[model samples]
Target chain A: MKLAHIQQILQAEVLTGAGSLDREVGMAFSADLISDILVMCKEHTLLLTGMTHIQIVKTAEICDLAAVVFVRGKRPGPEAIALAAQNDIPLLLSSLTMYESAGLLYCAGLPGISRNPDPCGRAKGERTG
Target chain B: MSEQAKPEQILILEFTLKSLDFMRAGEASSEFKQRLKKLGFKPELVRRAAIAAYEAEMNVIIHARKGVMRFEIAPARLLIVVEDEGPGISDIEQAMQEGFTTASAAIRELGFGAGMGLPNIKRCADAMDIQSIPGQGTRLQIIINNE
Candidate 1:
Protein backbone atom coordinates (compact mmCIF):
# COMPACT_ATOMS: atom_id res chain seq x y z
CA MET A 1 0.00 0.00 0.00
CA LYS A 2 1.14 3.52 -0.64
CA LEU A 3 1.62 5.79 2.35
CA ALA A 4 -0.81 8.21 0.78
CA HIS A 5 -3.43 5.51 0.77
CA ILE A 6 -2.68 4.80 4.43
CA GLN A 7 -3.13 8.47 5.22
CA GLN A 8 -6.48 8.42 3.48
CA ILE A 9 -7.61 5.29 5.28
CA LEU A 10 -6.49 6.37 8.76
CA GLN A 11 -6.84 10.14 8.39
CA ALA A 12 -3.19 10.47 9.24
CA GLU A 13 -1.13 13.63 9.38
CA VAL A 14 2.32 13.30 7.95
CA LEU A 15 4.78 14.85 10.38
CA THR A 16 7.94 14.31 8.36
CA GLY A 17 9.32 12.93 5.14
CA ALA A 18 6.26 14.32 3.36
CA GLY A 19 8.10 14.01 0.08
CA SER A 20 7.97 10.23 0.27
CA LEU A 21 4.21 9.79 0.44
CA ASP A 22 4.34 7.77 -2.77
CA ARG A 23 6.75 5.30 -1.22
CA GLU A 24 5.36 1.79 -1.09
CA VAL A 25 4.70 0.49 2.42
CA GLY A 26 5.44 -3.21 2.34
CA MET A 27 4.23 -5.05 5.48
CA ALA A 28 2.54 -3.63 8.57
CA PHE A 29 3.51 -4.48 12.14
CA SER A 30 1.33 -3.18 14.96
CA ALA A 31 3.00 -3.33 18.33
CA ASP A 32 4.08 -1.21 21.27
CA LEU A 33 6.99 -3.43 22.24
CA ILE A 34 10.21 -2.48 20.52
CA SER A 35 11.73 -5.94 20.86
CA ASP A 36 8.78 -7.64 19.22
CA ILE A 37 8.88 -5.00 16.52
CA LEU A 38 12.53 -5.71 15.84
CA VAL A 39 11.78 -9.42 15.56
CA MET A 40 8.72 -9.07 13.34
CA CYS A 41 9.39 -6.04 11.16
CA LYS A 42 11.18 -6.57 7.84
CA GLU A 43 13.26 -3.89 6.20
CA HIS A 44 11.04 -1.11 4.83
CA THR A 45 7.81 -2.38 6.45
CA LEU A 46 5.50 0.16 8.03
CA LEU A 47 5.35 0.28 11.83
CA LEU A 48 2.00 1.15 13.43
CA THR A 49 2.52 1.84 17.11
CA GLY A 50 1.33 3.82 20.13
CA MET A 51 4.70 4.63 21.64
CA THR A 52 5.83 8.07 20.49
CA HIS A 53 9.37 8.06 21.80
CA ILE A 54 12.80 8.62 20.36
CA GLN A 55 13.60 4.95 20.80
CA ILE A 56 10.85 4.06 18.34
CA VAL A 57 12.67 6.00 15.66
CA LYS A 58 15.93 4.42 16.70
CA THR A 59 14.40 0.96 16.48
CA ALA A 60 12.82 1.79 13.14
CA GLU A 61 16.16 3.00 11.83
CA ILE A 62 17.90 -0.14 13.02
CA CYS A 63 15.20 -2.41 11.57
CA ASP A 64 15.06 -0.33 8.38
CA LEU A 65 11.29 0.14 8.64
CA ALA A 66 9.71 2.23 5.93
CA ALA A 67 7.74 4.54 8.20
CA VAL A 68 5.94 4.87 11.51
CA VAL A 69 2.28 5.70 12.13
CA PHE A 70 1.57 6.81 15.68
CA VAL A 71 -1.85 5.57 16.87
CA ARG A 72 -4.24 7.31 19.30
CA GLY A 73 -3.13 10.73 18.13
CA LYS A 74 0.13 10.35 19.99
CA ARG A 75 2.28 12.89 18.25
CA PRO A 76 5.96 12.25 18.57
CA GLY A 77 7.97 14.50 20.83
CA PRO A 78 10.48 17.02 19.54
CA GLU A 79 13.49 14.77 19.88
CA ALA A 80 11.67 11.86 18.30
CA ILE A 81 10.51 14.00 15.41
CA ALA A 82 14.00 15.42 14.95
CA LEU A 83 15.50 11.96 15.02
CA ALA A 84 12.99 10.60 12.51
CA ALA A 85 13.51 13.58 10.28
CA GLN A 86 17.25 13.25 10.53
CA ASN A 87 17.01 9.56 9.78
CA ASP A 88 14.62 10.25 6.89
CA ILE A 89 11.87 7.97 8.21
CA PRO A 90 8.33 9.16 7.68
CA LEU A 91 6.25 9.81 10.79
CA LEU A 92 2.48 10.01 10.84
CA LEU A 93 -0.08 10.81 13.50
CA SER A 94 -3.57 9.27 13.50
CA SER A 95 -6.59 9.57 15.74
CA LEU A 96 -7.41 5.90 15.44
CA THR A 97 -6.29 3.45 18.08
CA MET A 98 -3.78 0.72 17.32
CA TYR A 99 -6.48 -1.91 16.82
CA GLU A 100 -8.48 0.31 14.53
CA SER A 101 -5.46 1.30 12.46
CA ALA A 102 -4.38 -2.33 12.15
CA GLY A 103 -7.86 -3.53 11.18
CA LEU A 104 -8.30 -0.87 8.54
CA LEU A 105 -4.94 -1.65 7.05
CA TYR A 106 -5.72 -5.37 7.00
CA CYS A 107 -9.10 -4.85 5.34
CA ALA A 108 -7.51 -2.59 2.77
CA GLY A 109 -5.30 -5.32 1.29
CA LEU A 110 -2.28 -4.64 3.48
CA PRO A 111 -0.71 -7.84 4.73
CA GLY A 112 0.46 -8.45 8.27
CA ILE A 113 4.15 -8.43 9.03
CA SER A 114 4.16 -12.21 8.91
CA ARG A 115 4.81 -14.04 5.66
CA ASN A 116 1.67 -16.14 6.05
CA PRO A 117 -1.69 -14.88 4.83
CA ASP A 118 -4.15 -13.33 7.21
CA PRO A 119 -6.41 -15.73 9.11
CA CYS A 120 -9.61 -14.13 7.79
CA GLY A 121 -9.10 -15.92 4.46
CA ARG A 122 -8.33 -12.69 2.68
CA ALA A 123 -6.44 -13.55 -0.48
CA LYS A 124 -2.88 -12.29 -0.32
CA GLY A 125 -1.66 -9.54 -2.63
CA GLU A 126 1.62 -9.23 -4.53
CA ARG A 127 3.94 -9.90 -1.61
CA THR A 128 7.47 -8.56 -2.09
CA GLY A 129 9.94 -6.46 -0.16
CA MET B 1 42.20 5.17 8.18
CA SER B 2 41.16 1.92 6.56
CA GLU B 3 44.10 2.18 4.21
CA GLN B 4 46.67 2.93 6.92
CA ALA B 5 45.50 0.39 9.50
CA LYS B 6 47.52 -2.77 9.95
CA PRO B 7 46.04 -5.93 8.47
CA GLU B 8 45.59 -7.44 11.95
CA GLN B 9 44.18 -4.31 13.59
CA ILE B 10 40.73 -4.63 15.22
CA LEU B 11 38.64 -1.48 14.84
CA ILE B 12 37.03 -1.05 18.24
CA LEU B 13 34.37 1.55 18.99
CA GLU B 14 33.60 1.99 22.69
CA PHE B 15 30.84 3.74 24.64
CA THR B 16 29.63 3.88 28.21
CA LEU B 17 25.99 2.98 28.90
CA LYS B 18 24.46 4.90 31.76
CA SER B 19 21.74 3.30 33.88
CA LEU B 20 18.08 4.12 33.26
CA ASP B 21 18.91 7.04 30.97
CA PHE B 22 15.77 6.83 28.91
CA MET B 23 16.55 10.02 27.02
CA ARG B 24 19.68 8.59 25.41
CA ALA B 25 18.89 4.89 25.61
CA GLY B 26 19.43 3.98 21.98
CA GLU B 27 22.02 6.56 21.08
CA ALA B 28 24.97 4.20 21.06
CA SER B 29 23.32 1.67 18.82
CA SER B 30 22.05 4.35 16.46
CA GLU B 31 25.53 5.78 16.14
CA PHE B 32 26.97 2.33 15.54
CA LYS B 33 24.25 1.66 12.99
CA GLN B 34 25.37 4.74 11.08
CA ARG B 35 28.96 3.57 11.25
CA LEU B 36 28.06 0.21 9.74
CA LYS B 37 26.00 1.85 7.05
CA LYS B 38 28.85 4.22 6.23
CA LEU B 39 31.24 1.28 6.12
CA GLY B 40 29.00 -0.31 3.47
CA PHE B 41 28.39 -3.65 5.10
CA LYS B 42 25.67 -5.60 3.30
CA PRO B 43 22.16 -4.60 4.31
CA GLU B 44 21.36 -7.84 6.12
CA LEU B 45 24.63 -7.92 8.05
CA VAL B 46 24.31 -4.27 8.98
CA ARG B 47 20.78 -4.89 10.30
CA ARG B 48 21.70 -7.97 12.29
CA ALA B 49 24.68 -6.22 13.82
CA ALA B 50 22.59 -3.20 14.71
CA ILE B 51 19.79 -5.21 16.31
CA ALA B 52 22.15 -7.34 18.33
CA ALA B 53 24.12 -4.27 19.43
CA TYR B 54 20.97 -2.35 20.32
CA GLU B 55 19.51 -5.15 22.43
CA ALA B 56 22.73 -5.60 24.37
CA GLU B 57 22.96 -1.87 24.98
CA MET B 58 19.40 -1.77 26.31
CA ASN B 59 20.07 -4.69 28.64
CA VAL B 60 22.86 -2.74 30.29
CA ILE B 61 20.93 0.52 30.49
CA ILE B 62 17.80 -1.07 31.98
CA HIS B 63 19.26 -3.72 34.25
CA ALA B 64 22.71 -2.54 35.29
CA ARG B 65 24.06 0.46 37.11
CA LYS B 66 26.60 1.15 34.36
CA GLY B 67 28.22 -0.68 31.47
CA VAL B 68 30.72 -0.54 28.66
CA MET B 69 29.76 -1.49 25.11
CA ARG B 70 32.44 -2.31 22.58
CA PHE B 71 31.82 -2.72 18.86
CA GLU B 72 34.66 -4.40 16.98
CA ILE B 73 34.62 -4.54 13.20
CA ALA B 74 37.20 -6.83 11.62
CA PRO B 75 37.65 -7.58 7.95
CA ALA B 76 35.27 -10.54 7.99
CA ARG B 77 33.35 -10.25 11.27
CA LEU B 78 31.53 -7.91 13.66
CA LEU B 79 31.88 -8.40 17.42
CA ILE B 80 29.88 -6.77 20.22
CA VAL B 81 30.75 -6.91 23.90
CA VAL B 82 28.69 -5.36 26.69
CA GLU B 83 29.80 -5.68 30.29
CA ASP B 84 27.65 -4.12 33.00
CA GLU B 85 28.09 -3.49 36.69
CA GLY B 86 24.82 -4.57 38.30
CA PRO B 87 23.00 -7.52 39.66
CA GLY B 88 23.98 -10.29 37.27
CA ILE B 89 21.86 -13.12 35.99
CA SER B 90 21.57 -16.22 38.13
CA ASP B 91 20.85 -18.57 35.25
CA ILE B 92 22.14 -17.88 31.78
CA GLU B 93 19.93 -20.61 30.33
CA GLN B 94 16.74 -19.09 31.74
CA ALA B 95 17.88 -15.63 30.67
CA MET B 96 18.35 -16.86 27.14
CA GLN B 97 14.73 -17.96 26.86
CA GLU B 98 12.39 -16.00 24.61
CA GLY B 99 9.98 -14.69 27.29
CA PHE B 100 11.81 -14.65 30.61
CA THR B 101 12.32 -10.99 31.34
CA THR B 102 12.74 -9.52 34.82
CA ALA B 103 12.02 -5.93 33.80
CA SER B 104 9.91 -3.86 36.15
CA ALA B 105 6.45 -2.49 35.36
CA ALA B 106 7.89 0.96 34.83
CA ILE B 107 10.36 -0.32 32.27
CA ARG B 108 7.57 -2.20 30.54
CA GLU B 109 5.65 1.03 30.17
CA LEU B 110 8.39 2.22 27.81
CA GLY B 111 7.71 -0.73 25.44
CA PHE B 112 10.69 -2.87 26.41
CA GLY B 113 11.05 -6.06 28.50
CA ALA B 114 9.36 -8.50 26.14
CA GLY B 115 12.18 -10.96 26.99
CA MET B 116 13.20 -10.99 23.36
CA GLY B 117 16.42 -9.00 23.88
CA LEU B 118 18.87 -11.81 24.45
CA PRO B 119 17.17 -14.31 22.20
CA ASN B 120 16.83 -11.80 19.40
CA ILE B 121 20.48 -10.86 19.76
CA LYS B 122 21.36 -14.53 19.57
CA ARG B 123 19.24 -14.94 16.48
CA CYS B 124 21.14 -12.16 14.75
CA ALA B 125 24.63 -13.05 15.94
CA ASP B 126 26.72 -15.77 14.31
CA ALA B 127 27.89 -16.76 17.83
CA MET B 128 27.37 -15.53 21.40
CA ASP B 129 28.56 -15.97 24.97
CA ILE B 130 27.12 -14.78 28.31
CA GLN B 131 28.84 -14.70 31.71
CA SER B 132 27.60 -13.37 35.01
CA ILE B 133 28.40 -13.46 38.70
CA PRO B 134 25.64 -13.18 41.25
CA GLY B 135 25.40 -9.72 42.91
CA GLN B 136 28.22 -8.49 40.71
CA GLY B 137 27.54 -7.98 37.00
CA THR B 138 27.08 -9.56 33.55
CA ARG B 139 29.04 -9.65 30.33
CA LEU B 140 27.58 -10.43 26.92
CA GLN B 141 29.53 -11.02 23.71
CA ILE B 142 28.01 -11.53 20.28
CA ILE B 143 29.54 -11.84 16.82
CA ILE B 144 28.16 -11.61 13.25
CA ASN B 145 30.06 -12.41 10.08
CA ASN B 146 30.29 -10.04 7.10
CA GLU B 147 29.35 -12.77 4.67
Candidate 2:
Protein backbone atom coordinates (compact mmCIF):
# COMPACT_ATOMS: atom_id res chain seq x y z
CA MET A 1 0.00 0.00 0.00
CA LYS A 2 1.10 3.52 -0.71
CA LEU A 3 1.84 5.74 2.24
CA ALA A 4 -0.83 8.08 1.03
CA HIS A 5 -3.42 5.39 1.57
CA ILE A 6 -2.11 4.72 5.03
CA GLN A 7 -2.34 8.39 5.85
CA GLN A 8 -5.95 8.39 4.71
CA ILE A 9 -6.83 5.20 6.56
CA LEU A 10 -5.41 6.35 9.86
CA GLN A 11 -6.06 10.05 9.40
CA ALA A 12 -2.44 10.69 10.24
CA GLU A 13 -0.73 14.03 9.90
CA VAL A 14 2.36 13.98 7.78
CA LEU A 15 5.18 15.59 9.70
CA THR A 16 7.90 14.99 7.11
CA GLY A 17 8.71 13.36 3.75
CA ALA A 18 5.45 14.43 2.17
CA GLY A 19 7.15 14.09 -1.19
CA SER A 20 7.41 10.32 -0.85
CA LEU A 21 3.82 9.52 -0.02
CA ASP A 22 3.58 7.53 -3.21
CA ARG A 23 6.12 5.02 -1.98
CA GLU A 24 4.66 1.56 -1.61
CA VAL A 25 5.12 -0.45 1.58
CA GLY A 26 3.90 -4.05 1.68
CA MET A 27 4.63 -4.93 5.28
CA ALA A 28 4.76 -3.26 8.69
CA PHE A 29 5.89 -4.02 12.21
CA SER A 30 4.96 -2.13 15.37
CA ALA A 31 7.09 -2.00 18.47
CA ASP A 32 8.11 0.49 21.11
CA LEU A 33 11.35 -1.42 21.51
CA ILE A 34 13.85 -0.17 18.97
CA SER A 35 15.79 -3.39 19.39
CA ASP A 36 12.80 -5.47 18.33
CA ILE A 37 12.28 -3.27 15.31
CA LEU A 38 15.91 -3.59 14.29
CA VAL A 39 15.89 -7.33 14.86
CA MET A 40 12.62 -8.16 13.16
CA CYS A 41 11.99 -5.60 10.46
CA LYS A 42 12.86 -6.03 6.79
CA GLU A 43 13.96 -3.36 4.38
CA HIS A 44 11.13 -1.05 3.27
CA THR A 45 8.91 -2.24 6.14
CA LEU A 46 6.77 0.44 7.70
CA LEU A 47 7.23 0.99 11.44
CA LEU A 48 4.38 1.83 13.80
CA THR A 49 5.88 2.99 17.04
CA GLY A 50 4.81 5.03 20.04
CA MET A 51 8.25 6.27 20.92
CA THR A 52 9.02 9.82 19.78
CA HIS A 53 12.76 10.17 19.98
CA ILE A 54 15.63 10.79 17.63
CA GLN A 55 16.49 7.12 17.89
CA ILE A 56 13.32 6.26 16.02
CA VAL A 57 14.47 8.37 13.15
CA LYS A 58 17.90 6.89 13.35
CA THR A 59 16.45 3.41 13.37
CA ALA A 60 14.46 4.18 10.27
CA GLU A 61 17.51 5.54 8.57
CA ILE A 62 19.73 2.64 9.50
CA CYS A 63 17.16 -0.04 8.71
CA ASP A 64 16.03 1.69 5.53
CA LEU A 65 12.45 1.62 6.85
CA ALA A 66 9.69 2.75 4.58
CA ALA A 67 8.40 5.30 7.12
CA VAL A 68 7.42 5.76 10.75
CA VAL A 69 3.95 6.25 12.14
CA PHE A 70 3.83 7.62 15.65
CA VAL A 71 0.79 6.17 17.38
CA ARG A 72 -1.41 7.48 20.18
CA GLY A 73 -1.24 11.08 19.03
CA LYS A 74 2.43 11.18 19.97
CA ARG A 75 4.42 13.86 18.25
CA PRO A 76 8.17 13.88 18.12
CA GLY A 77 10.19 16.96 18.93
CA PRO A 78 11.68 19.24 16.32
CA GLU A 79 15.00 17.46 16.49
CA ALA A 80 13.46 14.18 15.36
CA ILE A 81 11.42 15.94 12.70
CA ALA A 82 14.51 17.65 11.40
CA LEU A 83 16.45 14.39 11.29
CA ALA A 84 13.61 12.65 9.53
CA ALA A 85 13.36 15.49 7.07
CA GLN A 86 17.08 15.41 6.45
CA ASN A 87 16.91 11.69 5.79
CA ASP A 88 13.76 11.89 3.68
CA ILE A 89 12.03 9.47 6.01
CA PRO A 90 8.32 10.09 6.26
CA LEU A 91 7.10 10.72 9.79
CA LEU A 92 3.38 10.49 10.37
CA LEU A 93 1.32 11.11 13.50
CA SER A 94 -1.77 9.02 14.20
CA SER A 95 -4.16 9.44 17.08
CA LEU A 96 -5.04 5.76 17.05
CA THR A 97 -3.61 3.39 19.60
CA MET A 98 -0.81 1.09 18.45
CA TYR A 99 -3.09 -1.90 18.35
CA GLU A 100 -5.78 -0.01 16.48
CA SER A 101 -3.33 1.28 13.95
CA ALA A 102 -1.85 -2.16 13.42
CA GLY A 103 -5.28 -3.71 13.04
CA LEU A 104 -6.49 -1.12 10.56
CA LEU A 105 -3.39 -1.41 8.45
CA TYR A 106 -3.46 -5.18 8.57
CA CYS A 107 -7.08 -5.27 7.53
CA ALA A 108 -6.24 -3.05 4.63
CA GLY A 109 -4.17 -5.83 3.08
CA LEU A 110 -0.83 -4.89 4.60
CA PRO A 111 0.78 -7.99 6.06
CA GLY A 112 2.93 -7.96 9.13
CA ILE A 113 6.58 -8.99 8.89
CA SER A 114 7.48 -12.45 10.19
CA ARG A 115 10.92 -13.42 11.29
CA ASN A 116 12.79 -15.83 9.08
CA PRO A 117 14.22 -18.19 11.64
CA ASP A 118 17.78 -19.29 10.98
CA PRO A 119 17.94 -22.91 9.88
CA CYS A 120 20.16 -23.61 12.81
CA GLY A 121 18.37 -21.83 15.59
CA ARG A 122 20.27 -19.51 17.86
CA ALA A 123 23.58 -19.48 16.01
CA LYS A 124 26.20 -18.46 18.49
CA GLY A 125 29.02 -16.11 17.62
CA GLU A 126 32.67 -16.88 18.32
CA ARG A 127 33.74 -16.19 21.89
CA THR A 128 37.14 -14.88 20.87
CA GLY A 129 37.21 -11.43 19.27
CA MET B 1 31.42 -12.09 -5.98
CA SER B 2 34.40 -13.87 -4.44
CA GLU B 3 37.28 -12.09 -2.72
CA GLN B 4 39.62 -12.74 -5.68
CA ALA B 5 37.07 -11.28 -8.10
CA LYS B 6 37.95 -7.75 -7.00
CA PRO B 7 40.98 -5.89 -5.79
CA GLU B 8 41.43 -5.32 -2.05
CA GLN B 9 40.87 -1.62 -1.54
CA ILE B 10 39.88 -1.40 2.14
CA LEU B 11 38.04 1.88 2.73
CA ILE B 12 38.27 2.90 6.35
CA LEU B 13 36.00 5.23 8.32
CA GLU B 14 35.98 5.95 12.02
CA PHE B 15 33.62 7.75 14.41
CA THR B 16 33.74 8.37 18.13
CA LEU B 17 30.71 7.90 20.37
CA LYS B 18 29.98 9.39 23.76
CA SER B 19 28.13 7.79 26.60
CA LEU B 20 24.44 8.63 27.15
CA ASP B 21 24.38 10.65 23.94
CA PHE B 22 21.07 9.42 22.62
CA MET B 23 20.74 12.34 20.24
CA ARG B 24 23.80 11.42 18.18
CA ALA B 25 24.05 7.69 18.79
CA GLY B 26 23.15 6.43 15.33
CA GLU B 27 24.96 9.03 13.24
CA ALA B 28 27.87 6.77 12.46
CA SER B 29 25.62 3.94 11.31
CA SER B 30 23.58 6.25 9.11
CA GLU B 31 26.71 7.53 7.47
CA PHE B 32 27.89 3.95 6.96
CA LYS B 33 24.58 3.08 5.29
CA GLN B 34 24.90 5.98 2.88
CA ARG B 35 28.45 5.06 2.07
CA LEU B 36 27.49 1.45 1.34
CA LYS B 37 24.57 2.57 -0.79
CA LYS B 38 26.73 4.95 -2.76
CA LEU B 39 29.23 2.15 -3.20
CA GLY B 40 26.44 0.11 -4.85
CA PHE B 41 25.74 -2.54 -2.20
CA LYS B 42 22.39 -4.26 -2.41
CA PRO B 43 19.69 -2.76 -0.20
CA GLU B 44 19.38 -5.89 1.96
CA LEU B 45 23.11 -6.09 2.57
CA VAL B 46 23.33 -2.39 3.25
CA ARG B 47 20.47 -2.55 5.74
CA ARG B 48 22.02 -5.50 7.57
CA ALA B 49 25.40 -3.78 7.76
CA ALA B 50 23.90 -0.51 8.90
CA ILE B 51 21.60 -2.13 11.48
CA ALA B 52 24.42 -4.21 12.92
CA ALA B 53 26.68 -1.19 13.12
CA TYR B 54 23.92 0.90 14.65
CA GLU B 55 23.25 -1.68 17.36
CA ALA B 56 26.94 -1.84 18.17
CA GLU B 57 27.11 1.93 18.35
CA MET B 58 24.12 2.04 20.66
CA ASN B 59 25.73 -0.48 22.97
CA VAL B 60 28.61 1.91 23.47
CA ILE B 61 26.42 4.94 23.99
CA ILE B 62 24.18 3.19 26.48
CA HIS B 63 26.82 1.30 28.41
CA ALA B 64 30.31 2.60 27.74
CA ARG B 65 32.11 5.68 28.96
CA LYS B 66 33.42 6.31 25.44
CA GLY B 67 33.85 4.29 22.29
CA VAL B 68 35.09 4.28 18.74
CA MET B 69 33.39 2.63 15.77
CA ARG B 70 35.71 1.71 12.94
CA PHE B 71 34.63 0.40 9.56
CA GLU B 72 36.82 -1.36 7.01
CA ILE B 73 34.98 -1.74 3.74
CA ALA B 74 36.36 -4.06 1.11
CA PRO B 75 34.93 -5.25 -2.19
CA ALA B 76 33.62 -8.58 -0.87
CA ARG B 77 32.97 -7.79 2.79
CA LEU B 78 32.61 -5.06 5.40
CA LEU B 79 34.16 -5.22 8.86
CA ILE B 80 32.93 -3.14 11.79
CA VAL B 81 34.91 -2.94 14.97
CA VAL B 82 33.49 -1.23 18.04
CA GLU B 83 35.83 -0.74 20.96
CA ASP B 84 34.61 0.84 24.12
CA GLU B 85 36.18 1.87 27.39
CA GLY B 86 33.47 0.98 29.82
CA PRO B 87 32.37 -1.60 32.33
CA GLY B 88 32.87 -4.66 30.23
CA ILE B 89 30.59 -7.63 30.15
CA SER B 90 31.14 -9.99 33.04
CA ASP B 91 29.60 -12.89 31.21
CA ILE B 92 29.56 -12.83 27.44
CA GLU B 93 27.15 -15.74 27.20
CA GLN B 94 24.53 -14.14 29.42
CA ALA B 95 24.93 -10.82 27.68
CA MET B 96 24.24 -12.37 24.30
CA GLN B 97 20.98 -13.87 25.44
CA GLU B 98 17.93 -12.12 24.03
CA GLY B 99 15.92 -10.09 26.57
CA PHE B 100 18.87 -10.00 28.96
CA THR B 101 19.74 -6.36 29.55
CA THR B 102 21.48 -4.47 32.32
CA ALA B 103 20.53 -1.04 31.00
CA SER B 104 19.35 1.60 33.39
CA ALA B 105 15.73 2.63 33.37
CA ALA B 106 16.66 5.95 31.82
CA ILE B 107 18.21 4.23 28.80
CA ARG B 108 15.28 1.88 28.56
CA GLU B 109 12.89 4.82 28.41
CA LEU B 110 14.34 5.73 25.05
CA GLY B 111 12.90 2.55 23.54
CA PHE B 112 16.11 0.57 23.77
CA GLY B 113 17.78 -1.92 26.12
CA ALA B 114 15.58 -4.90 25.68
CA GLY B 115 18.75 -6.95 25.59
CA MET B 116 18.52 -7.64 21.89
CA GLY B 117 21.40 -5.52 20.64
CA LEU B 118 24.16 -8.10 20.45
CA PRO B 119 21.85 -10.86 19.36
CA ASN B 120 20.44 -8.61 16.66
CA ILE B 121 23.97 -7.84 15.53
CA LYS B 122 24.79 -11.54 15.43
CA ARG B 123 21.70 -12.16 13.34
CA CYS B 124 22.56 -9.40 10.89
CA ALA B 125 26.23 -10.05 10.38
CA ASP B 126 27.81 -13.06 8.73
CA ALA B 127 30.16 -13.41 11.68
CA MET B 128 30.48 -11.70 15.07
CA ASP B 129 33.37 -11.76 17.51
CA ILE B 130 33.25 -10.27 20.98
CA GLN B 131 35.87 -9.99 23.69
CA SER B 132 35.38 -8.23 26.96
CA ILE B 133 37.48 -7.88 30.10
CA PRO B 134 35.47 -7.52 33.24
CA GLY B 135 35.79 -4.01 34.72
CA GLN B 136 37.86 -2.98 31.71
CA GLY B 137 36.28 -2.82 28.23
CA THR B 138 34.70 -4.68 25.31
CA ARG B 139 35.69 -5.06 21.70
CA LEU B 140 33.13 -6.20 19.12
CA GLN B 141 33.91 -7.21 15.56
CA ILE B 142 31.17 -7.72 12.96
CA ILE B 143 31.66 -8.80 9.37
CA ILE B 144 28.97 -8.67 6.66
CA ASN B 145 29.53 -10.25 3.29
CA ASN B 146 28.96 -8.03 0.27
CA GLU B 147 29.26 -9.31 -3.26
Per-residue CA lDDT of candidate 2, range B1-147, in tens?
Answer: 012223467778889999998777888888888988999988889888998999999999999999989888887989999999999999999999999999999888888899999999999999999999988899999999876
What is the model-wide C-alpha lDDT for candidate 1?
0.87
Positional deviation of B54 in candidate 1, in angstroms? 0.5
Global Cα RMSD, each model: 3.8, 9.3
TM-score of 1: 0.92
lDDT of 1 by residue, A71-110 (tens): 9999889989988899899999999999999888887778
Q: After superposition, how far is residue B39 of candidate 2 from its true place, in Å?
A: 0.7
Q: Return the top candidate by lDDT.
A: 2
Evaluated against the true structure, the overall lDDT of model 2 is: 0.89
The alpha-carbon lDDT assigned to residue A109 of candidate 2 equals 65
* CAPRI accuracy category, model 1: medium
Q: Report the C-alpha displacement of residue B51, candidate 2, in angstroms.
A: 0.9
Model 2's i-RMS, to one decimal, reads: 0.8
Off by over 4 Å in 2: A115-129, B1-7
